[model samples]
Target chain A: MRPLGDDTGPAIEVRGLRKLYGQTVALHDIDFEVSKGEIFAVLGPNGAGKTTTVEILEGFRPREGGTVKVLGEDPFRADEEWRARIGVVLQTTGEFEDLNVREVVRHFARYYPDAQDPDELIERVGLAEKRNARASKLSGGQQRRLDVALGIIGRPEVLFLDEPTTGFDPSSRRDFWQLIRDLATSGTTIVLTTHYLEEAEQLADRVAVIVGGRILDIGVPQTLGGRDTEATVVSWMGPDGLESVHTTAPTKFAADLHARLGGEAPGLTVHRPSLEDVYLQMIGADTAATAALASAAGVTTEDS
Target chain B: MTVLTVAPARRLPRARLRRIASLGLYRGQLELLQFFRGTETVVFSLLFPVFALVIFSSMFDGEIAPGVTYSDYLVPGIIATGLMVTGFQTLAISIAIERDRGGLKRIAATPMPRSAYFIGKVIMVLVTSVVETVVLVAVSVVLYGTHLPGTADAWLTFGWVSLLGVTACALCGIALSSLPRNSRSAPAVVAPFAFVLQFISGAALVFTDLPPWLQWIASAFPLKWMCQGLRSVFLPDSYAAQEAAHSWQLGWVAVALIAWVILGTVLCLATFRWTKTRDGG
Candidate 1:
């Protein structure tokens, strides 16, 4: 097959994507794009449709309505070449129980035309310590790490990770994050779905907030829900006691406090809204908005 | 990406086809490795038929025909059972479990040709069934004076019959794997299904000794034909008189097995599912 799209276009594109699990609408008109080499994160709570969206993009699930293109080809109709360009790391999997970590990695490497060196990939994912450990013998965290190694062994052009690092320790998560960053720098597009908002802030170039089967917002982590310009909570020790103020400009507030003290302000701290704060606030707002609509409809009562 | 001069929508180039074939070979090799390494399954599948043969040979120590001993009859029956156990029961249960584990879905995500998985599974089935057959044959030959096919023609018959039996049973496994609701229920569903078939198909019970209704029912299935085909090779020509037909219907046996192979292929292609996601997304 000839190349699908120009290298400059977005690596993944979705528009008006809709999915239903029987009668229940699982995803409603979801929309987004992951540009080439960009690390895009999807943030949502459990059952908030993050996995559904990611699965659809990964060609693991079918959408009832909408168009999706990963690497400029519809994933549902993608050929082997199209498939060779993408990789997926699901939440958890049980496979190769009899095979060791090294064997499993090497097994997956055979699927692609151009694959990463299995040993180097295992090392990159920090499975070197347990390279010979049987899959069934691995701890929960180690199993998840092996899954990550398998996902990247194909050297895919685009990778999909759904709640990766769930079972990882702090250091492992850090190492995994570094590995992701390295992959992105080498022009691998990544779409990550995570419940951990800090992970989104840490690795995602852009983040999408999906709630109740709909996308609430999509922007850079710093500006998601206007986090960059939104009010920052600044606190200081005043003459009376401790004082806190919400201001759009935290630096000016801190400077004013510094001037008032004619020196460094004691216990003075400036804090902007974190990505987690914005995510939770967005989810809370969506909940509140639905509740408001329900109450406006007389608390779900039928009209007489 | 390599630029191509001619554009064909679905036709793969020769080199890619070769690569896919080689990849499937590698996948098959790994599958065999995994199967042999699996201790519990390996031991159970390998010995179940041999045990049945030994028990039956001891229980029925009389002449099946004038020159044919019960061991001669039981060897072929047990070989048929061995093929079914490896090709049908074990394969179905293992595939169900693997699908539940997301292994099939993971493989589906790769650029790996769909044929690679089937090739791998078929190779495992073929090799294990042959091994199961050989172990049962050797045990009968050494311990019970059971004779093997001495002539080249008889040996060729054995080979083709064994190959067809394995192909039909493996396809049955692939098709019926979708019947189980989930992995936990697979063994429960597949084992009893195979168990009842063996009894009715004369692998466990004597085909001619059973009632005409059971005989007719057995005749309709491939397992009975497989046993009949094997019995013709392992037993003396006089033993054909003991068959339900009073003669070895090798022609009808081949037809039934080939028909079942076709049916199983259709069902496998039509019903094989990579994932059974009953939980709402």
Candidate 2:
């Protein structure tokens, strides 16, 4: 890896990025910036333009309109030098026949001017045991591990991973998350899209929700859509049975409950909406808004 | 909680064709490795032509001319058949699978030079063609008692015919790869086309017996001329009476082959894709 110069700028920048297939827009007005070392997660449901957005940035797909810059270079007009700086793990792709884990990694390693040791990379991605196993022989999760190893082999400054850990078991997912963090800790800017909300909450420093070809919200996980500040649900085992209240003042509400019986409030518990909760809420709200706009414009939806 | 810095992007060194050639040569080694590793596919694809030659030569057993055995006439055409199978059939399947199967698109994202890949494919075709040639010719001379070409002129003709034939067929294979909707359907398109071409083009040793329309169809493709060119190398000049033109026509064969190579190049440029979908870029 080369030394980073003293330039203060985001690793990735997108302004008014738009994509279209015929008259239907796949993505529009898409914009965001990812600082170096930040783990930025793009969260969305299926067909929400997540893949389109990432593909445009990865230079695999052309955009209709936008100013997109990755590492101070236009990715759409990307050159070899620009390619050397970025890594991509696209949503599950076909692996090569006859190439074992180590060989494929080493093969990709040669494409870069500076690449991590193939053996060390295999170990890093936790495919050490399967180093000699041919690609066809590996299980799905193992194959994904190989994909991750190949993605980071060049020691890319910015890595784009689209559902990279889809097939992993729980333990492997955790290990993979830790490996992602290790990469970020060393100053690699990471952008990942995944169906797993907990993955975003656990790994992302900041997250964005994209829905219907546009951004629904963007914020740190704790405060995304005010998840941290959303009304908390307070519950306790009351005289009749379990009772509950949704309140912004959970602490005060709990105290009031505590004093009401002049004793312990049995089975008292408090919790707020989680990341998944807020994310689904945002998707739901977006759907309603789009439907309302369509109805007002007298455009009949498919279901309608 | 902390700021981060990353390695700065740098420009590539100047375009050096020598460096590109060496890089391509290295990638070619991996291509060879992958090919040989698929033991069943390699063995079956290369051996089918040799076996076909033996069966047809034995069944058509007799001297077609004064002391000119059928094996003598059959060996060269079979060698051409070997080249077609290795260069056209195998390459089309492999490249289609490699593309739709995800390897090409993955490679596309890297800093690997675009030319290196085609160069690697060329090298792979050359290496495999060599194996097919050695095996087919050895079987012809040692097992069937076929005579070797007696002159350097014959050997020179052999070299150019084999080279041009493989180049043309291999490029056609690549151009045709994107025609398959996906890797799974590659053989569905390639196999029938290759087999049909060989029969009509004289690999079955029946080009003269085919209907005029069929012969004309064979003449339109590179395989017929390739087979005709190879036949000129092994059979005596007097045996040219058996050919449709009653002349060697080696020059026309070369011209036809070079034309196919040019056409194949154009088709490859127009139709090739890194992936199966229209979204492929």
Best by TM-score: 2
lDDT of each: 0.82, 0.82
Winning model by lDDT? 2
Cα lDDT tens digits for candidate 2, A138-218: 888988988888888889999999887787888999999999999999999999988888888889999999999999889
Please write out the lDDT profile of model 2 over residues B1-281, one tens digit for every residue.
00011123343435546556877998899989988898887888788988898898878878877767777877888899899988899999988988786788788777776778889999999999999999998898898887778999999999999999999999999999988988889999899989888889977765677898999989999999988998888887887888888887999999999999999999988777765564411
Candidate 1 per-residue lDDT over residues A185-300, each given as its tens digit: 99999999876667888899999988889999999987899878877778778889888788888888888888888998788767666676666678884432332122111121
The DockQ of predicted model 1 stands at: 0.36
TM-score (C-alpha) between model 2 and the true structure: 0.90
Q: For chain B alone, what TM-score does every candidate structure achieve against the true structure?
A: 0.94, 0.92
Q: What TM-score does each of the candidates earn?
A: 0.89, 0.90
